[model samples]
Target: MLAEADNGAELAASMAELKAYLRIESDGEDAVLAGLLRSAAALCEQFVGQWLIRRGARETVPADGRWHRLAARPVVAIGAVAAVDDAGAVTPLPVEAYAIDIDASGDGWVRAVRPGNRLAVEYQAGMATDLNGVAEPLRQGIMRLAAEHFVARGDEGAAPPAVVSALWRPWRRMRLS
Candidate 1:
């Protein structure tokens, strides 16, 4: 399971940023705008198939006798790996036990020299955690989407704007399966 270190207390866009982007002069809708910003960020993450915010994740994967791909994208760091026995005893594996690998799109994997019944991996993954970490194009894309959402006022369906897709297209991960 993936769990954010901050429990998602930080957002890609701040309340002030959203307010400025949406051109809101009144504070009455600040709460609503904040929620909308979060919703837009989440939708953008889903659309792009990567985390836009820094999130810590712990995953327990069944060893398949080879490399194991991580569930999340843009893996920033691998914290630890451990072996879980049938009795649920966890043994922390040494750093040399596995080799970390990442693709161009930031998809990460671990090649374990000795495969076990279960392997637990702790990692951090995301494209960014704050506005500064986000690229200008992506930031603009988020703003546009949030603006669209705000204008639509929850009346529109789940479909995202074309601009959002275009901005995030380059960063999206491609599956070769």
Candidate 2:
């Protein structure tokens, strides 16, 4: 459970709703939510540094409302998400408000929103950079860092800080109201 707001009170209330809302049915306990979880991990791994650190629930609340909670019930070995900036700074990441989850077989898709904002990175490149043209493996690598770096390589100070997806969100500004 995680939520974002300029004020702590609003975020707390939202977290409560988040926790209650994420329960899975017995059948849902199976593989119903696996792909979405994978995509969430990829999103986290792809936006490291720019989005900073994993999310945190309001201290006033009794539960931990980090974005990783989504993976918690699913028994995902790897969990957590943070967006870092170009300067390599770490700050609390936003909760995942919503995302697109699709069936690989193209059967269907669903839109899901969690409690808080997802880590949004900020990076820039030259005209020839063509970031959109990056290969899928590199994209997955970026997603890997966004999801797993903090626990394994980034903050824990592994021999070599793990590879993270660092980028600038120039066109996309925070819709903070």
lDDT of 1 by residue, 30-128 (tens): 777767777777777777788887888988777656887898888988888888789988889887776777777688887667776788889999877
Model 1 ranges with Cα > 4 A deviation: 5-7, 154-159
Q: What lDDT does the true structure give each of the candidates?
A: 0.76, 0.29
Instruction: Tell me the RMSD of model 1 versus the true structure.
Output: 2.3
In the order shown, the candidates' Cα RMSDs to the true structure are 2.3, 20.5
TM-score between model 2 and native: 0.18
Worst 10 residues of 2 by lDDT: 69-78
Q: lDDT: which candidate is best?
A: 1
How high is each candidate's TM-score?
0.85, 0.18
What lDDT score goes with residue 59 in model 1? 85
Give the per-residue lDDT of model 2 (tens digit) for 60-162. 1112224221211111122233433446454544445323222232111112244422333221111112223333444344334323432352345443224
